[model samples]
Structures are given as C-alpha cells and as structure tokens.
Target chain A: MQYENPKIPEGINVTKVHPLKTFAILVSGLLVMLLVGAWLLGFGGGYLASKIPYSQEQRIADSYEGDAGLEQTELLRYLQALADKLSQQMNLEDGMDITIHYVDEGVDNAFATIGGHIFLYRGLLEKLPHENALAMLVAHEIAHVKHRDPIVSIGRGAAISVGMKLLLGDASPSLLGNAGLLTQMRFGRDMETKADQAGLVAVNTIYGGVTGALALFEILDGIEDNGLVKSPEFLSTHPASENRLDELREIANRNGWSMDNTPVPFPEFFNRSLLLR
Target chain B: MIFQILLILVLLILGYFVGSHLEKKHYQSIIKREEMLRDIPAVASKILPPGSENFNQVLVMGNVTISVDYFKRFLAALHNFFGGRVTSYESLLDRARREAILRMKEEAAVLKATLVLNIKYETASIYKGGGKAIGSVEVLAYGTAMIPKASIDAV
Candidate 1:
C-alpha cells in the first residue's frame, strides 16, 4: 500500500487544538478577568466618588434643570424664610447655598437634591398642623443637604454606570442620559438614620425642645396608619416612622429636652384651606 | 458577590462542555464525509483531463455558516481588551470553510462527476442585530463539476 499523505492546500493555515482544553482555558481566563474587573470598580469607584469637589456636585445638580414652579410666590417666600431660619442651626459647608422650591402639586413628598435644592410639595405642606412641625420637616431635609447625601448617592450611581459600560461595551445613550427624576433618588439606611439624628439636633437648637420633632413623627405615624402612605420598610427610602420616633424620644430623654412645648401658629401667608378634602 | 462569580463560572463551564461535545461530533462527521468524497477529486484549475472534450461541466456550490458558543465569545471579547490574535474565533472560521468545501464535493459527487475544477471560496462574517461583535461566519465553496463523456454515454 502506498503510504504518502496528501499535502495541505496552500495559503491555508490550520491549527490543531484540544477542544476541551482550549475551552477550559478560555472560560477560566474570562471568569478571572471579570471578577478582577468587578472588584477593582467596586473599591476604586467608591474611593473616587468621595473625593469629588463641591463645585462639581453643584454642576451635576444644575444639569437636572428641574421645574421652576411658583418660584416667586408669597407662600414660597414664607417657606424659604422659614427654611433659612432653621438652616442657621446646621453646620453647612462653604459655598453651599440651600435653595427652597415650592411645587404647587398635590403629591405628598419632599426631597433634597445634589445642589442644596429642597423641593417641598403643597400636599405635604398643607398637612402640617403648625409652624414648628413645618420647621422640623425643613430641618430634616436640610440635614440631608448638610451631610451631602445627594452628592454621595449621585457619585455612587455614576461610578457604577461607567464601570458597567467599560465592562459590557457601550450602553444605550438614553439610559446613560437619564440623570434626572428626584423621585428615583435613594440614600442608604445609615444616611437616613444620620439625617434623623442630625435633624433632631437642629430642631432642638431652633425650638429649644424636641416637641416639633416628636409632633412631626406623630403626624407621619397617623398618616401611615391611615394607609395613605404605602412605603413599606424595605421599599422606603426613609427609615420607618415608628423607629425614628423611638430614636427621637431616646435622644430627647438623654439630653433632658422637653417634648411637650406648644407649637407656634402658622404664618398668615400659609394657606390652610389646601388641606381640606 | 462570590455567588455571582460562581454562577458565571458555572455557566461558562456548561457552555464549554456543551460546545466541545458539539464540535467534536461535527468534526467526526466531517472526517467520515471527507473519506467518502475523497475519490471525487477537486482542483483549482480550469483545465480538463486529456481526451475529455465531450464531458459536461456545471457549477456546483455549497454554503455553510457556523457560530461560536458563549464561552468562545467571552474569550474573544477578553482578547479584544488586550489586543491580540483572537485564536478562539479562528477555529470557528476554519470549521466553516472545511465544512463548506466538503459539502461542495458531496454535491459534485451526486452528479457522477469525475473531478471538480476551478474551485473558489468566499467568507463573510454575520452579525446579530446591530452589535459590533461577530455572531457567525458564512463560507461559500463553488466549483465546476465535470462528468466524463463515456460515463454519460454509457448511461
């Protein structure tokens, strides 16, 4: 029998490989790289986010261009004056100006944003029984700004987004461009608890007691019990009202602060008819 | 986080095993078919055998498309990061080419062709949707199949 093999065709390069071995090598290499990339992004991004400057945070917040509803109204002026009075008790960073905006909507929500902008909805404002409770509410939101919670949240979100794009190729532009929507903003549980304690201190300093803070909790507890608020503990961005009240009571008792002081009357410009169903 | 990594590793391993088995089976089938079509010679020249003026010539073609598994795709993506030869994709293209040629030879054999002449091949990458990454490769093999005059006359 003739024992000559056919010559391989010209211009064709062939590489013989053990299929299973090659597959194993490829899979292991990919897994290792992915794991290392995720780890680097997690720790590296967190460190980098904390070092962003206040000016950069303000720029990011300005990019949102939120609705300027009722910016020059008398009620808005009253609210801003009250917020300014409460903010005096907070230790704000330099160049950080807190601007209060009043939204004449029927939604029951208040939120603090990156550029020291606090949005107060008419629905929540109308429910306040007195001016002290309103001051407590404003103090809580101011505390969020004082702690730079919004900037921190935005930094973490941006870091994760950039990391994902780097790892998974280019993401859709629409998803990347959607940086607005204050309702979608979230802060960690620890930040919320810190805001609560700091807000209690601010209210105590302004009203000479914790009566407004406790009354604020009582109002929230009543609203929560009426099933008007559906935010469960896990789904809520804020801590549970009951737990926050207990913590407020503990802090007030430990500091020998009275919780039974009379709440001041609402200002003349504050319209109470909006609360009527 | 550890669980996420473990899950990804498990998926990769599964893809590797399944893809390896499929490739091995396909290779075995290709070898068997190559042996069966060996006697029908294929050449890259238009010249016919001497004294075969009465032979009939017709074009025969075969096309094949092969895709890589998820493991190989992940490997190639990693290779892209480092800018190296993507060896994982090479095998996929090679298989497509060989399979196309073999299928062309099988088509020529069906016509009782003594030989296939002026064989040519073309290849193109097929992408899924609008993404940048290649999903598969299509290889087309074409040749002129020649039937001997005497065999046709006898039939």
Candidate 2:
C-alpha cells in the first residue's frame, strides 16, 4: 500500500490562528487536564489506599507515640474484655488485633488510628453510664480499623498534598506534615456512614440489640446541644450525632433489630474518677 | 472546594484579559513609534548606508525589564507539565524585545541621531524569593547611533 502526502492548498494562511480561538482552546485544554487530573488522583488514590497491608499500617500507627497513660488497671481490663467481646462479633480480617489504650487525658474523644490501636480518653470514658453504649463506641472504632480507614486516609492525604505541590509549586513542610490530619478531618461522609452501619451490626450481634448505638448517639447529641463541645458538627470528622442516630435507626429498622435491650451497668472501677486518672 | 476552584478560574481569566489588554496597548504604541522612526533605521549591520562621511558615532543603549503576570506564570507552569510551546511566555518575551528596541530608538532620538547601527540585545532572567519564582526578564538593547553632523550643527 502506498501512502501519499496530502498537498497544501495555494494562498492558504494556515499559520495564522485567531487570538480568541487560541485562547479558548488553550484555556479549555488546561481546565480539562486539571479536572481530569483531580478526578484521577481522587479515585485512583482511594482505590490504591484501600489495599495497603495491615502490617505496614501498624508501622505507620506505631510512629505516632501518644502521651503517657495509666498502666493496666481494673477499668483498662474491663474495657479490654469489652473490646474483646465486640471483636468476637465483628467480621474482622485475619492478622487484625484490637488493642485498647487508656489515655489519662481529660479530652472527650475516642479515636482509632492506622493499626488496631484504639485510644479511649478518660473524659469520654467517665461520661459512659452503661457497658452497651461503651461497646457501641468501641465497635465503631473497630469498624474503622477493619475497613483500614486510617491507612486509606493517610494515602489519600499524601496523594492530595503531592498533587497540590505539583499544581501550585508550594510544598511547605507544614502542609505535608499536616496532610494526614487534614484528610482525617475531611473523612468522606460515606466512610462515616459505613462505619456507623457496620458498628450497629456489630453491636447487634454482640448484645442481641441496637439500643446501645442509639443511646450512645443520644448522649452525644445531648452533649452537643448543651454546647459543652465547641467544635461544630460541620467541622467534625465524624457525622453529627443526630444524623448518626437517624442512620442507626434506619439500619435497625431495615434489619428488624431490637433497640430496647437492658443496659449493662458500668464496672465499679469506672465510678472512681481518681482511679480513671 | 468549589469556591477555591472558582477563585483560581477567575484569576486565570482576569490575568488573560488584563495581560492581553496591556500587551495590545504596548503593541499599538510600538507600531506607532516604529512608523514614526521609519526614516531613522536601526539595523544589526557593520557598515553604514552609502552616505558622505559626515556623521558622529555615539554608543546608545536602552534597558527594560518586564514581569510576567500571574496568568502567564500559571500558563507556563501548566505548559511545563505537558511539554509544549508556552505561547503566554512567547508573547511576554516578544513584548520585552520590542519595548527594549523602542527605548533604544528613543535614546538615539535624544542624541539627535538619524540612524542606529550594529544593534544588539542581551537578555537575562531575574529570579526572586530565593529563586522560587521568575521575577522578571531584563532586555538590554544597545547600538551605535550615527548623528548626521548637519543635524547637530543645526542644533
């Protein structure tokens, strides 16, 4: 087969491009590249992040040395037993172990990081009235661990920071260092919703009911209404307590799970605030 | 997130329109001056035109530095990724070159010179903020101005 070159038309000024047309084409092309790059980074990064190994996640989690905490006490033992009970009910993957940490901080918060490490603040622990509500909180954090959310979050954070640096040419050390926290705080609503659902399921399996999940959210909702916590729901990493309660109700209704189980009393050691410290 | 993206887009559009407007105005001024100085030719030649040897030669020079606007810098960064002709920067250098030549002509005019010969342009990049960003480009246009001794004598 012969390939023939096309002949150019005579008197055609092909080199001259309309300025407006050129501007439009260039700008649109740039916008397309930016949008496509963003989409690819978001979706591709999320997909890759979800597949990171549990061992590597543990390494990442180990790097974060949290503040000193009280050694193994009765409350710590009871909390550990409760976490073990919830762990038995969860659909956890192999090689994943839940290690509960008792921090002496007065902050009202409980968080699960990259590994199976769960940090329960004394302030949040002091607020719990029953074992079931505490179980719900523990199960929720475990759900985050089972889903490898911390690792995925870190991955997405690093991806976004790198993308920003490439696009903006401003890669300050502080920006890179705070990438994990930024992504964690902006945890997609879908992830929060998923954790809530999984947590309810785990709670139901362990206690044969879902009241603990509802009760936990109701307490949080009450605390929020009192303005004891200054952080607004809009800025929080987790969904609002009321929204989570609604979602828990929907899940319970869908599963036909009971929401009126007997409340398990808190352990005797939990009653003493000094012992908690 | 949407607001941030919108802000960037607004900045790019503003840069394009404003930068293009400034460039067009400069081009207009340059064309007008070029027309006015048509008779007083500037060339990169060693020999002068076939005129009687009755002219004074003096060194004349003009230096100009112009900064790239935000939009052009943004465009250049984008071009860096795709590896193509950076048209925005092309126009920027073009404006600088013409402005430098025009200034050199003005200098010759001040010296009562009718023609400038052996015109040369030296360009350099000036970086700022610890070499983080390109601050501006300096273009130095120099030439030997030939003052027809008659024009000086008249003066």
Candidate 3:
C-alpha cells in the first residue's frame, strides 16, 4: 500500500478575494455611514442648541470657574468698552451680554465662547492698525455671541460624539464637557461667514466706512504670511483673509457703504495698555 | 479631528501594502518548502504500519508562531462588528498550520523515518504588547516517526 500526502490546491481554506477589495468595501461603507450620521447629528444638534435660551446657556457656562479670580485690567476694560459699543451698533437684543476677556499672552488669537465671553490675546491686539479695525475684530466676536455659535458648536460636538461612541466604541475623544467646550469650540464655516457679514455691517455703521474692516483682514493676512499664527486650531477656525477681504468689498458695493474713510486712530493709552500685565 | 483622520489613513495604507507583500512572500516560501518535504508523509492515524517491529520509533515535532498584520487585525475587528466569517484570520492560521506541519515533516526526514503517524496539532493565541493587543498565534505539531530498525545486520 502506497502512503502519500498529495499536494493540496492553494486557496482551499483562505478566501481568494484580494484583501483590499474587502477592505475598500468595509472602509468606504464605514466612511459613508460616519459622514451621513455626522451631518445629520450636526444639523440636529445645531438646531437644538440654537433653540436653547441665552439665559439658560449662560447658566451652563457659569458652571466653569476658569475666570473666577481674573481681575478687570485696563486692557480688559477697553476691550469691554469697545465690545459694548460694537454690540449697540450691531443692534444686539436686550439683555444680550457680550463680555470681553483680555489675555496678556502674545498668542495671536481672538475667539468667542459660550455665555457671550470673548477672549482677546495681546499678540493679535498689538497688530490692529486702528480703532475701526479693533471695532471690526470685536464686532466679529460679538456676532458670534449674538448667533449663539459657541453653544451650538458644543451641542453639535456632543451629539456627534454620542453617535460615534455607539457605533465605533471609544475610538475618539468625547468633545463634550467643560474643558473641551471652553478650549476647543470649532464653529462651522457658515458661522464664520455669517459673523463676518454681521461684523462688517456693524463696523460700517460705527465707523461710516468699511476701511478698518479691510485693514483687519490685511493685518490678519500679513500675520498669516509672516507665519506667526501657526496653530492649526487657530487657522482652522477663521476664514481665509483674502476671501474675507473680497467679500467685504462686495458687501460694501451691494450695501453702498463707503470702502474708504479716515480710519479712527487707536486711543492714546492703547499701545501702553496692551503691554501691561 | 482632521489630524486624527489623516493618521488613521496613513496607518491603513501602510498596513495594507506591507501586510499583503509579506503574506504573499510567506505563502510562496511555505509552498516551496511543502513541496520539498512531501517525501516524508505525516498522517493523523493512530495505528502503526505493518512490520513496524523491524523499525525504530521516535517523536518528531514542530512549532510555529505567527502574527496578523494591523490591516488584517482591523479587518477582523470590522468582521466582529458585522458578524461574519473572519476571512482575514483564515489566511494567518492557514499559513501557521502549514508551516508547523512542514517543520514536523522536515524533522521526520532528518530522522531518516519512513513514515510519521498519530500526528496532532495544538493551537494557542498570545498577546505580545498587552493584554488587549492580540499579537500572534502559535501552532505546534507533533508525531511519532518510524525508522528502519537495521534488523538485516542481526545475521
């Protein structure tokens, strides 16, 4: 009797399908599901979040004590005063508080947060060419507060994260909670565009021209070209300065607001106060 | 968020290309070795061949440990989610089993055995990086080899 182990054919136990075929199908399907789910959740969340009353949102924001002991400095008072005047020009509704927080650090960034709090850094402030441009900057942040973008962004993040956790487990960090909400509020592109328009309109009303508004974008673009604000987080939030400049011109043309004016110079104490602690 | 997504993309692409290349190379080597060692037959039967009294018996064994690439592991995880045949792991186990058997057969050939019988396989999983990081699968093959007893020299 002959005993032999004949050569078995290949692909007997293993599937002959190319690994990438299955991978492509699986990965693409997952991406589509994630994208669709994220979009729906983001829309639903933004809508629901926007529905939240300003007063209640303020209560939620008050839960954080990050600024509990921060005192009002000369810079803070000036920014607050600028923000208040810009808020009036923007026709902010009654009881809509726009608070300004001035940070002495030279990090080139200015952003709004929940409860109408806007934080401005000295690095970005020092670059402002005039008071009108400052009004434009403050108006932009005030516009964010007026639109309640911070809470909406938080709501969008929370909803998406909940969905992701259910589908993909804990693969990503949850974008909810106080620290994430405060430090990492990423407003949508449309939010920035709308805020830009609102800000341009308000500055035009206050300064009788969009001259300083254009200067604000020029200074921001110069900073970008100088490679000063290299943080991806900061870059990702604000719209491109060139695009904003074109849009500002277009907005001026359509609204018949003057594109050129003698821009109001900064206050006598502006340069000195920005350098103070 | 963008950075995280980019990182996952980079890992997936690297895993796929490198993993497929290595797997193909391994299969080629396994097939070539299997063909070379086919002269020594290893069977899973318990009964000894007739005239075994004129033969020597010895234990022949082989062991192999193999790991799945990150791409295959990720695919398997996806399979776990959808509940289907884990095709990615099939190739990994197949390679390990064949390699183990081939090593056992090579040992049998070295012992100058005519046949190997009662062959059995043991399989286990080992985690290398951590308790949760599944690292590799180990396959051990063992058998009894029958060699010529040199009875003709007894005269």
Candidate 4:
C-alpha cells in the first residue's frame, strides 16, 4: 500500500518522475528504433542489394552440384546440342555456351537454370510430339540466358544471401530448410516468364519458331488439366500463367508466325531412344 | 520495501537482458533468407522495347519484421521474470523473411531488372546490452538488391 502513497496529492508526482518517465522514454525510443529499423531493413537493404552480381554459370554449376545425379548428365548433353542449333539460328555470339542435362527419371519437368544449364525431365521429353515444341522450350530458356534474366534473379538472391550472412556470421545451418528452398523458387519464377518472351523472339526470328511456343503451352495445359502427377518440379519452378501464354501467342501472331498446315513430324529419334527402358 | 524494490529492479534487468538475447533469433532468420537468395542466379532486366514504363515501378519490401505483438509477449515475460515459449518466435521470424523477399522483388521491378539475384543480408543490433534499464528490442536489416546487368543496360 506504501507504493500507492506516491499517487496521492501530497506526494510528489512519481508517475511524472523517474521510473515511469524512464518507461515512457524507453517506449519512445523503441518506436523510433522500429521506424528507422524498417527503413534500413526495407529501402536501405533493397538499395544496397541491387549492387551484388548474380552470375548465371555459377548458379547452374551450384544447382548441378546440389543435385548431382548420373541421369542428368546425358540430358545436359542433349540440351547443349539444342542450344547450339538455336544459338546459331538466333545468331548468338560464338562464345555463348548452352549446356543441357537429361535426367533418367520420368517426371514431366524441365528447368532452365540460369547461365546455360537446361534440365529436361525424362517424362517431359517423352511427351513432346514435335521438335517445334522442343525448339520453343530451348529458345525460351536461351532467351533468359541472353537477356541476363538469371543474373537478375540471382542478384535478388544475392541481396538476401548477403543479408543472411551478416546476420548469422556464416555459421547458421538454417539455410538447409524448406524456407531456404522457397525463397529461391519464388525469385526463380520471374526469370521463367522473362525467358519465355525472350525465347519466343529468338525462335520467331527463324520461320518455324512460333509453333514451338504454342505446342509447348498445349502440352503444359494438358498436364495441368489432367492432374497426373501431384507437383511436377518444372511446373512448380515456372508457374504457368494463362495470361502469359496467351500473350506469347499474341506476340507470335503479331510477328506473322501462323499455325500453318505443315505439320512437324514427330522425330523417329523418340522411338530410337530407350528412354522408357 | 527496499528489498522488494531491489528484487523488482533485478528482475527487470534480468528480463531486459533475456528479451534482447531472444530478439537475436528473428534477426538470424532474416539473414538466412538472404543467404538463400544469394545462392540463386540473378539476371539483368530486359524491358520489352515498347513497354518501358513498367520498369519504373520498384516494389521494395521493408526489413523483415516480426510482429510487435509477438515480441510484446516475449518482453512481457521478461517483465514478470518468467520465461514463456521460445517456438512462438518462429512464425514471426518466418513472416519477416517472406516479406523481405517480396519487397526485394518489388525493388527489382522499380530498378527494371528482369531478375534481382544474388542477394545477401546484414543485420545490426538496434538495441544492445547498455539499454537494459528500459527494456527495448530492435534490429537493423540491410542487403544487396541486384538486377541483371543486361536489363539495367537495356534501360
């Protein structure tokens, strides 16, 4: 009850005095810290984050290392050949390298890792009915590489990476968790869309390139509608935007690339390859 | 009364120290997300030739912040000199990291990079040990916001 005495009229205003005043002061300080902290963490972090370099080749190499499997090596070779042909057609610089890996397992998936690495799932390769579609796929990925889309995506990642390193002092193991993977995936999606546009343009420069984009979309649409596999990594990596696909078609049409009757025969190479075996 | 006052002061000091110590965790998660971003490839922006205006809108995510309410609970226990749940901090930490990432992308948009890649974060203590008397917690986040060289050059 003696503490209550301080609140009485005769007593000095303790609430206006030391301890309570200290509390108010502390609270004010906390608010200022929050405001400043938000700015530093948000805009300041973003500003500084844009400066880091996001290398394409290095990221592809790291992805390969992270999931190094024997099956992917062959796929990588096949993709490399495709990239070379597309490069030649697009008149890409001679020094540009395209590497492709074919994984053995049948998962309808393909991912164009930044740099020149293209991973094609066995299931996805099995599904393609024409070389045009395959060309479209490769062309799109190459576009990402040419346009430096991967580098931009990775730069965003680099900003986050630098931030984490500073906070954890290079020792925290939390980077191995699902949260880590999602952050990478989220940023990767933007690059996928950019690559699609770029890929279309590169292919369209040649006569039959536009068909590739359309055919690829048709294949993807069927897969999504059927709900065959639960979560295909390719679909997960590059989210299919209906609007985006329509835009691609519109772009192709605008360029006078039409759906002509000259059907691209399914390559006999598909039958010759013992991929299912 | 004197002993009680001494006891209360001691408890408050202890609580302040513990609260600040626990605050370090949220900071750690924010940093971890940055590291993950760095591991990925980053590309430069390549704006479509006709539509360059979209490139001007930059979306910046503020520093990943755990809820003040969540942090308030942690601090409350400090005032009471009683420890509560530690796992309660995880969600807040996660929320902050996610927000930071989203903000990074927005910033990239404004910067006109096709991909904002290779990001990392640095954390600083907003309030350290000396501020124990008036229990407060604060952390500063900073990271690189990268856009592809191609896109940046294109613009």
Question: Per-residue alpha-carbon lDDT of model 3 for A1-277, expressed as tens digits?
Answer: 2588898889899887877888788878878878998999988998999999998888887764357335866666777888888998888878788877777788989998988888888899899988988899889999999988998998888888888788767845646567787776999878999999999989988889999888999998888888955555445767778877888799899989997799999888889887655
> Candidate 1 clashing pairs?
none
Q: Against the true structure, whose lDDT is highest?
A: 3
lDDT of 2 by residue, A1-277 (tens): 1112233242132224444565567778888987888767876776797888887767656654453354667877888888888887896888798888887777778887767888888777778778788998999889888887766776676677679788788765663353454235345677777878888888888788988668988887877777755687678767888888887898899889997887777866676843534
Segments of candidate 1 deviating more than 4 angstroms:
A1-50, A59-66, A172-184, A222-235, A272-277, B1-155
Best candidate (score: DockQ): 3
Ranking by DockQ: 3, 1, 2, 4
- Give the residue spans of candidate 4 off by over 4 A: A1-79, A168-190, A207-209, A227-239, A274-276, B1-155
Candidate by candidate, in order, the iRMS in Å equals 5.8, 15.7, 1.3, 24.3
- The DockQ of each candidate is 0.12, 0.06, 0.53, 0.01
Docking class of 4: incorrect
TM-score of chain B of 1: 0.88
True contacts kept of 2: 0.00
- What is the C-alpha lDDT profile of model 1 across A1-277, one tens digit per residue? 1112364553254455654555566658777977777656645654675677878777867754556664476677888888887777787877877888877787778889877899888878777888888888888889888887876665565666677787668854543254443654678778888988888888888778888778887887877787756788988767788988998899899999878887787876577434432
TM-score, cand. 2: 0.64
Candidate 4's error at B18, in angstroms?
Answer: 21
Best by TM-score: 3
